[model samples]
Target: MNRFLLVILFLFFALGAFAMGQKAVVNLDEYLLSNTKSGYTNVMVEDMVFSWKLQGQDIFVKIFAPLEGWLAIGFDPAEKMKGADYIIGIISNGAPMINEHYGDNPYGHKSIVLLGGKDLTGNKEGLENKDGTMIGFSIPQDPQDNFHKKLLPGSTHKVILAYGADKNMKARHAKRYIIEIKL
Candidate 1:
């Protein structure tokens, strides 16, 4: 009986931790296809265009921009990139790739931490425009990582849309804007 009690206690704590983490993993293709989500579109000064759909706590976003190199959409940009998260989409070697990163005010390796890398192909997709590539992805309304900023529903936040020449994210961007998200 004691051993069974201990096991139950352990499971309870583990489940609690997972729920608090707020990771909320979601499949991009499944979420988009399951809902008849009306697209909410936004445009930046640099012509980097994006649209997002919100269903419950899931947010599906797609970004398309004119870039000789790469395009990115960042969330919660303030003062710098100190407390912002961004997903960069690039066409590399005739393929579409996605990288999740968090900015710590500066745009460099030391200031940014990578979360995950994704490939846009098959069911997980977006159209690649001639001028730029489109990347479709999904993130939670509330991120699990304590290091990232929180995305609140019905409330807008600062956003950054940028593009640069280097795939390494080292080049000076052709355009960068600290705009507001259309929440």
Candidate 2:
């Protein structure tokens, strides 16, 4: 039984069976997108920006790495807000279907826009890359959710970071975290 102690007891049970089939961190924070969106009461997921135009100077940014918390913008006459939040829902092509509590006067709705708010748990602030590596958010960008602007000029927007209020979430995309913008 001494072949180097049987390969060190089979590499200690194969690294304890790969750490018990991994997946812990509370099921990866219950599959991100801020725990399935809606009017985040106070979950505080500060920033996430994904701008567009690469071969042309306007390549705006933000998004450093698996960030899943900090967002506290406001307005909810019934769009409601509470814990377990993070909701962005915009769908505009032919306009008129704005829901975040009466949709304001934003008029046209450009390809789904709904970035959530409320969750400043003691003001921590994490994601920030500064000069280009993305991850930056000092808020401000909701001019009535960026008023449509020809359904978003130079477009290619299809973002989803959910949980806020679920709404079936279309099979939930395992919690939805896809921010790819090319405006």
Candidate 3:
């Protein structure tokens, strides 16, 4: 009886451990596909597709552009590219990298880290295929940074989307678009 009880207790603990290990992991493809199907606002500019959704206090964004270079989105530019916050995504050696940037001038931007700001992005994902490159990430609606504009739901804001010709970020964008989106 004692041995049987011990075996039963062990089995119960094993089952509990197994359940604890079953955490959900979301990959880049899953994130884009799931959100696309679940009411993400999608806009097509030329050959690029920009999708965004606001969940709770954070906004998730996905950009798909037909280029092998860096893709970027700028929020609430004061004029041209000035006074805006930017998120740039690149795939290097099959790994995804996301960078936060602040628009320093009408034609240029610098990394947020260089300007003494933190990277307030999460859940970054990227994929490069024969068709195009797709990148996704999430950021808080109010990042509380001087460089970043406050993004509010139900408000319309101007956004800039661009992509380079190659993986070099310093190179000029091959194509650019400016449009207004309602969050």
Q: For each candidate in the order shown, give its overall lDDT on alpha carbons.
A: 0.62, 0.29, 0.85
Weakest 10 consecutive residues of candidate 1 by summed lDDT: 115-124
Instruction: Please estimate how well model 2 matches the true structure, expressed as its whole-model Cα lDDT.
Output: 0.29
State every prediction's TM-score relative to the real structure: 0.64, 0.25, 0.80
Which should have the higher lDDT, number 1 or number 3?
Answer: 3
Model 3 per-residue lDDT tens digits across residues 1-183: 699999999999999999887643434466457767987877887778889989888998888888678999999889788888999988887678989999889989999889888889898989886556888899999778687777888888999999999889988799999998887
2 or 3, which is superior by TM-score? Answer: 3
lDDT of 3 at 88: 94
Separate clash counts for every candidate:
2, 31, 0
Model 3 RMSD vs true structure? 9.4
Candidate 2: clashing residue pairs, number? 31
Instruction: Pick the TM-score winner.
Output: 3
For lDDT, the strongest prediction is 3
Ranking by TM-score: 3, 1, 2
What residue pairs are clashing in model 3? none
Model 1 TM-score on a 0 to 1 scale: 0.64
